[model samples]
Target chain A: MVDPKLLNFDTLSVHAGQHPDTDHGARAVPIYQTTSYVFRDVDHAAGLFNLERQGHIYSRISNPTVAALEERLAALEGGVGAIATSSGMSALFLAIATLMSAGDHIVSSSALYGGANNLLATTLPRFGITTTFVNPRDTDGFRAAIRPETRLVYGETLGNPGLEIMDVEAVSAVAHESGVPLMLDNTFATPVLFRPFEWGVDLSYHSITKFIGGHGVAIGGALVDSGRFDWTASGKFPTLTEPYPSYHGLRFAEEFGTQAFLIRARVEGLRDFGAPLAPQNAFYILQGTETLGIRMQRHVANTRAIVEYLSGREEVSWISYPELPDHPDHDRAARLMPDGCGAIFAFGIKGGRQAGRKFIKKLKIFSHLANVGDAKSLVIHPASTTHATMSSEQLEKAGIGEDLIRLSIGLEDPDDLIDDLSSALRASRK
Target chain B: MTELLVRGARVSASCGGREPDPSLPLLVFVHGAALDRTCWQLQSRYFAFRGFSVVAVDLPGHGRSEGPLCASVEEYADWLAELVEAAGYHQAHLVGHSMGALITLEAAARHPGRISSLTLCGGAAAIPVHPGLLSAAQNGDDIAYRLMASWGHSRRSHLGGHPTPGLWMMGGSIRLWERTPPGVLASDLAACDRYRRGREAARQVGCPTLLISGSQDIMTPNRSANPLRNGIKTLAEVTIEDAGHIMIVEQPDRVIDALDGFLTGL
Candidate 1:
C-alpha cells in the first residue's frame, strides 16, 4: 500500500488514474469504447440510476476510459474531481451553464481566448447572463464589478495572445470577499507548469487539445473542482445549496459535500448538454499527459531560447513572454509560476501586418495554425485568425495589434527553431 | 434529510430522499470519526429504496447535526440508542464504520433489545490513536487529514478507477475531512483513542452480527478484529479484496452486497 500523498508529480502523471487491467492484463489504459454497460439485474440498473451505486450507465454521462482521464487530470491538478468535455469551449460553456441562471452575472478578465470572450460577452448575454470585463492587472476592477447576481470571476492563468499573467491569489481573494468563485482557464499553463488549486483558485478548466494532449490529434476539455469553495456559504448558488427537483429534490451541496459542483455539472450539465469526450480521444490525451512533466520542461527551455533570439532581431518590435524583465507581468509570473512560464507567447514584427504575414509564410519549420500547445511548433496571427470574430475595438482592448504574431514553442532543438526564425525574419524585411 | 431531537439537540440524517417509514424494517447507519452520513450515501440510499428504511445519521457536532461533541464512544453509544427511539424505531438493524462501529458495538451491548442486528465495517476490538497523529489533529494540522485520507484507502484506490464516475476518491475524502468543524476531529480522534471496552462490549452483544473487513485495510487489519470475531456469539465475516478501511466508499457494491445478504437473511 503505497500512499498516493507520498507519490511525486511525475509518478502520479503516469499512474494516478489507472491500474493494470483486471479483466485482461493490459498495461496501458484500455479504451472502453462502448455506449452503455450491462446491468447484472433490474436492481443493479436501478441502483446506478438512483445514484445508489457507483458505476457508468450511459456513455454521455460517463465512460470508463474517459473517467480514467478525468481522474488523472484531477490528481495532477490537485482538484477533488473533474469532468471531461468534447472541446475546451464546451467545458467553459458547461461550467458557465452549471453556475449561472437567467439573471446571473460574471466578472471576467479582458485578456482571454477569443472563443471564451465571445461566450461571455456575446452569447451568454443573449440568454440573460451578463458580464463585466476588466483588465487582468486591475484587481480592484474585479472587486468593483461584482453585482449581487455575480456568481463567478473568470480569467486565464496565462492570458491568451497577450501572455499576461493573472495575479490568481489576489483575484481569488477578491472573489471570496464577494462570495463568488474564481475560475481560471489553465490551458496555456498546464498542471505541469502550474497547479491552480494550490493558489486560491476555486475552479479550473483546460483545453486538453493543446499541451495536455501533446499531439494535436484530439480536441478535448475538462472542468476541475478544487472542492475548497463553499457554495453553501456563498448563499448565492441555489443550484448547489437548494434541493434539485429533477433528482428527487436532492441538494447537491448536501448530498455530495465538497464535490457538489462537479457532481451537479455532470448529473445536470453533461446529462442535458450532451458533449462528452470520446474514449479514443481520452486515451490519446492520456498518452500525452503521461509525458507532460518532461515535455513541458523541453517546451519551456525551447521557448526561452527563442524569446532570447527574438529580442536581438531588429525585425522584432516587442515580445510578451513574461520571463523578459520588460514584460508587464514578469515579476508576478516569477512569484506565481516558479517552475516556468508557458511556451505560447506573442511578439511584434517591425513591418506590421504585411510583414507579419510574410514572416509566417517564410517560416519553414513552424506550422501556421489556429491552435497552441502542440508537440511541433505553431504560429498564428490572432487579429486575422483566432480573434477575427472580435471587432477592432475589442482587439485593441485585448492588447492585440496587426503586427502581433503568436508562437507556440515546441520540443524541437532550440537551435533549429532559431535558425528557421532567423531566416524568416530576414525574408520578412522590406 | 430527517431532523431528529436526541438529548435536547438537533440531529440530522439522510433518509435516502424520503422520510423513514416506520412500516419498513429500520436500518441505521453510523459514520466514522471526522466523517459524516454522506460516507454511506450509496449504501443508505440502496437499502432505503430496496424495502429497508435507512437513516445514516451525522453524529453530534458532525455534518448537519447540532450538539456538543461526545467525549467518548460510550457517550456516542448512548446518543445512538436515543436516536433510534426518537426516529420512532423500537429495534433496528445497525451498520457502522470505524469509530461508528465502536459506537454500534457499545450501543448493542448496553441496549441489546433495541438493536435487532449489527454490522461492523473496518472495525477492531481496540483502536489506539498514535500520539503524533493525536497531537497533529489536536492542533488542526493538515498532516493529520493527509495521513488519514492516505492511509484510509488501498494503494489501488490511489490510482483512480472509482466505481463512481468522475469522482477522485482520495481527493474527495480529504475535502470531506477538511470540512470537519474545528476541534471536532481532534475530539473524535481522542474519543476513538480512549475507547477500551470494545472487546467486552462485543461479548455482550447477543444480536446477529456481521463483521466486514477489507483485505487491504491497513488502518484496521483483519488480525486487529480477532478479538471481536472470537467474542461475538453469532458472527458472519466478509473480506472484500483490494479494499481499505473506507470500504464503504472504496467498494460500495461489495459492502452493499455483504450487508444485503446478511440483513436479508436475518
Candidate 2:
C-alpha cells in the first residue's frame, strides 16, 4: 500500500496528525485547558461513567490537545493507541503499572537512562515488582534474567548516552517464549530513526524531553501500544483479561480490542497518578514533532562531520560515535540507523581530565549545558557532571569514561563547529 | 575575613561558596594575566546552577588581592595552588583561558595532586616574546592594550553577540586590563615569557585534559599550541572555527559545548 510519490518523512511529519475540527472551524488543535466536561444530563453522565460512551471526563484523564498529541505519536510510531504523561519517568511508571502488579518482574537493559535506572533498580522494588538488568545487546542475558513472573522485557532502541543498539527481534523472541511482551524505550532513536514496534516490540515509550521536542522548551512523555500482543492468549496478563472493579468490572481486552493496553494505561495509571501532560507543553511538543524529520536529518549530518573532524585531530584520544569506521558498533549503526546514528556522541581527550577541562574553557561556539537536543550545539563532561552521582563501576558499565565528552551536534554549518573545536583544542594544549 | 598571605600579599581565603552537593565536583577558575577573577562571571553562574562548587580568585595586583607583579611564572603557579587548597578542592576541574591557561598548566604540574582535570583556552606552551611589542610596552606606548585588543578578538566579532560587559564583572574582583597597573602588566607579560612548562609538564598531568583554541587567535596562534598538545599523553581538542583569542567573550556557546562535553564526561 506504499505510494512511491507520497511516501516521504517530511510529508508524514506535517500531515500525519492533522484533522479538521467539525464544530468550530478551528484549524489548529485548541488547548482544552478544561477540568471537567459537563454532561447533557444525568443519563448522559451515567452512560459516560459506565463506559457506554466515548468522551472526555476530566483533564487528568484526557484532554483535546493531549489526545491530538497521543494520536499523532501513535500514528508516527504505527501503534494502535498512545497515552501522554507529565514526564518520561511517568510514562515508564504508567507503562509498568498497567501491565504488572505485586510479585511481577521485568528484565531490562543495563544502559537505561539514569532516572529509569533508578526507577527499575531502586524504586520498583518497594512495590514488590523487581527488574533484572542485562547487557543491552545480550539476547541470552535477557532470556536468562526472565522468570515465570516476568511481565515484560525492556530495552532502549538506542540506550541513553552509551548509544547501544538493542537487537529487538532477538530479545522479542526470548520474551514471546515466556508470554511476556517486549517493551522498548524509543526515546533516543525516536520514531523517526527506529520504530521498535516494526521490529517485534509489543510496546514503545518516548521521553519527549530530548530530540522529540527539538527546542528543549517542554517536558512530556508517551506510551504507545503496538496492539500485537494478545493479552487473552498470553494468560499471564490477567489485569487485561480479568474484570477490573475500578472501571465497573470492565475487561480491557474484551472491551477495547486492539487498544486494550493503551486504554488501561490511561484509565488505570494516568487516571490514578494524575500525571497528565499540560495542554501548553503538549502543544509545544506537537509543534516540535512537525519538523522532527528534517531536524533529525540535519542533526545526523552535522554529527557525522564533527565525528570525522574529532577523529582526525591529533589531540583527541578516542571517539565513540558509531558512524565512525573505527567504532566497534560501526556495522550495527549503519544497518540500524543508516540515515545517521545520531547527533550525539562521546570522545575522550588526549590530556585526560585536565585537558578536558581546558578544552571546555576555550570553546567559543559550543554551549556547555546539561540539557541535550537543542537547536544549538551542546557539550558536557559526563563523568564530572550528569554521571557524577554514579559510582565508578556504574560509570564504566554505562561506557562513560572519566575522559569522555558528549557532544550534541546542532544544525549549524559543520565547518563552523569544526573550526570552533579546532581552536578550542589549540588553546587547551597551551 | 581571614586573609591568607601568599607571596607576602593578603588574599581572601577561599570560603566554601554555595550549596554543597557531595556528589558534585568542584571547579576552580583561574583568570588570565590581565583580567581578574570576574572574567569567569558567566561560567561561575552557569556551572553553579549545574551543581558544581565554583571558586574564582583575583590574581595578585589585579583585584583586591595584594601583591606586586613578580617576573616569574613559578610564583603565579604557587599562588594558584594556594587558592585551590584554600577552596577545599584538593582536586578540581581547573579551567584556564588565555593567560590563565599557562598558570593552570604550571600549577597542575607543580601541585599535581590538586587538579582533577585541566581545561586550557587560548594558551601556548611557549609564547614567543615579540621584540616590537615588548619594546612598545616598556616605552609606555600603551602596547598592552593594542596587544590585548588583538588577542581579545577577531575583526568580525560584534559586542551584541556577547552578553553585556557587566556580566563579566559579576564576581567581587574585576579589572579590565586597561585599568590594571602598568608594572603589573609588564610583570605579567615577562612572567609569560619566562613561563616554559614544556612537554614534560603536560606529560606529567595525571588527569584528563582538554585543549581549546580559537581559529583566529593571533595572540597564541594555532601553530604555537603544538608543544602543549604534543606533550600531553591524552588530550581532546575543540577548535572554535570562527572565534578569535577572546573566546569567553566572542563565542560563549562553543566554550559551553567544550565545557559540557568535558564536564559531563568527567
Candidate 3:
C-alpha cells in the first residue's frame, strides 16, 4: 500500500494539516480570530473541559489556525502531535515544565542558543529545577551527568558557533538505557533538512521565527512528540503516569496514549502560563511554511558558495561549517542531514573583535542582527553580542571565539553575498 | 495505557487510570481491518474519563500490535477473548466497527457469557465484499488502497469536513489503510464474505445491543444491517446524518451521545 505519509516533502508542506475552511470555502487557512468558541451546548462545553471530546474551547488552549500549524509541523516531523507556542524559549520551557516539577533535574548540551543556556543555567535553578551542562561533543558527559532526579536529556541539533552535529542516534540510546527521553532543539536544521524523530530522538522543537517562517515575520515555536518513546516503560515520569488533581485526575499517558506529551503541554503548560501563538502569527507562519522546502534549498546552496569563497580569502583565519572535512562532525552531518548541514555557520577573520565589528559595519546587504534563519543575509560577532555576558572561561567552553563571525546566508544571488563579504573582509583589514 | 504480549500477539490498549475498578465493567474497542487503535483515540480518552475502563486495540499486524495476521474472523475473536482474560477481566463490553463487528459477533456466539453487551458500528453480519476490491487487495496493488479509501467515505466526507479541528478525514482514512500490511485487507475481506451466520450469531447474543448506522454510509448503510437488527430481540438503532462508513470521524459527538446514552441506560 502507498503510505499517505510517504508523500514527498514538497507535497506535504502545502497540503498536510488543512482542508479548505468548510464554513466559508476559504482555500487558505482562516485566522479564527476570536477569544473563545461557542459550544454546541453546556454539555459540549463540559465534555471539552473534561477531556471527553476533541474540539476547541478557549483560544489559549487551542485555536483552529494554530492547530492547523501544529498539525502541519506534526506531519512534517512524523510526530503524533505538536503544540505551537509564543516563542522558541516558551516551547523549551513548556517541554521542561511538563516533564518535571520542583526538585527535578536535567542533563543538557552546553552548546545551545545563549538564551536557552541562560534559562538552564540561571532561570531554571531559581525555580528549584537544576541542570548539569555537558559538552556537546562529550557523549559520556551526558550519560555521567544524569542523576536520580533527572527528567530528560537535552541537546541542540547543531551546536552554537562551532557547528557541532550531535550523533542523535547514539545519544538517544544512552538516554533510553537510563529510561529518559532525548529532546533536540532543531531550530537550525528545519524538518526540510532533518527530522530528529527519524534518528530516534523522542521530542524536538523549532523556533518558527527561523527558516520555518522564512520571511521572519512571525515569532513562534513548535514542540513535536515522536510517539515512539514509551513513557510508561520509563516508570519515572509520574506527571504522565500518575493521576492529577486537575481535570478529574486524568493521567495523560493512560488516556491520550501516543499523544500524551503533546496534550499535557497544551492543557497544563499553555493553559496555566498562557503563552499561546496568536492565530495571526500562526497564519503567517503557515504561509511561510508553504514555501519552506524550496527556501531551504536556496539557503543551503547560497551558503556553500559563501563558505568556499571565505576559505580562499586571505583575510579569513578559519571557517567552521559541518561540510568542511576538518570539522569534527563533518561525517555525521553527511549521514544525518545529508541534504545540507544548514545555511548558518560561524567563521573567524584575520583580526580580533575590533576587526569583526568593522566587518559587520562594512557590509551593506548583510544586516547586523543576532537572529539566524532569515530571508535577508545577516552578520554578527556572536562573542560580543549573544555571549557578551558570559565569563571568558564560559565563553571558551561554549566555543565562541572573540574573533568569530556568524553569517546567516539568504536566497540572494551568491555572487552578491560573496562580493559583499569579500569587500567587508578587505575593509576590516585595512 | 497498557501494552501487553498476549499469547504472542502484541495487544495495545487504553484503560482507566493505572489500575481500574474491577466492579466497573470494561469497554473494549476493536478497529476495522486496515485501521489501528488511533481511529478510536478521541472516543477512548473520553470514555476513560467517564468512569469506565476503556481499551482500544491495535489488532494483530496493525499499528503497535505485532502479529502474523490471523486469516479468519474466528481466529481474531479467539485472540480478543484471550486478551481480555490476560488483562484480568472476566467480562467486557465489546465495541466493534466494520470487520471488527463480525469478530465481535463470532465471539458472542462462541463465548456467550464473556461479552456483557455489544455495540456495532458501520457493520453488518453478512458483509459481502466487492469482487474487484478483493482481487485488487489480493494482488497487493497500491491502487487497491487508493480505491478503498476514496470509495469508502460518503460524498460529504470526500468533500473534507471533519468534526474535529486540525484533522482531514479523507487524509486520515487513507493513512489508516496505508499503515496496515499489504495482504491483511484481502484476507479480512475474504473472511467477512465467507461468514454467513449473521442471524445465528445475533440470536446467541444474550445481552442488550446498540447499532450505530451512518445515514449515508455506502459501505454498510442502514439497509444492509436491517436483517441483523431484526435478529436482535433487545436492540436500539441510531442513524447519524451526513456521515459515511467512518462515522466516528464524521460525527463523533452524535455517535458518542447515542453510545453514552445506551451504555448509561444499561
**Candidates' TM-scores?**
0.97, 0.60, 0.84
Candidate 2 per-residue lDDT over residues B109-177, each given as its tens digit: 888888888998887886655666555556655544555554457543421112221011101011155
Better of 1 and 3 by lDDT: 1
Clashing pairs in 1: none
Q: DockQ rank, highest first?
A: 1, 3, 2
Chain B of candidate 1 versus the native chain B: what TM-score? 0.99
lDDT of 2 by residue, A161-269 (tens): 7678777788999999999999988877778888777688988889887888888889899888777787867899988988788865656664443556776777778
Looking at model 1, residue B164 earns an lDDT score of 81
TM-score of chain B of 2: 0.86
Question: How well is each residue in A114-165 modelled by candidate 1, as lDDT tens digits?
Answer: 9999999999999999999999999999999999999999999999889887
Lowest-sum lDDT 10-residue window in model 2 chain A = A1-10
Candidate lDDT scores, in order, read 0.91, 0.73, 0.82
lDDT of 3 by residue, A1-430 (tens): 3332245567668866677776898999899999998888877777788766878988998898898888788768766668899999999999999999899999998888888988998899999999998888888888899998898999899987678977788889989989999999999999989999879898999999999998878999989877767777788898887887896677776665566777788888889988999999999999888999999999999999999989998888889999999898999999999999899999988779888888998999999988889999988888778878777887888899988999999989999998899889889997
RMSD of 3: 4.9
* Root-mean-square deviation (CA) per prediction: 1.7, 31.8, 4.9
Residue-level lDDT tens digits of model 3 in B8-68: 7667766544345666678889988777776776777667767678788878877667887
Q: Show where candidate 2 strays beyond 4 Å.
A: A1-9, B1-266
- Model 1 CAPRI rating: medium
Candidate 3 recovers a fraction of native contacts equal to 0.25
RMSD of 1: 1.7
| Leading candidate by TM-score | 1
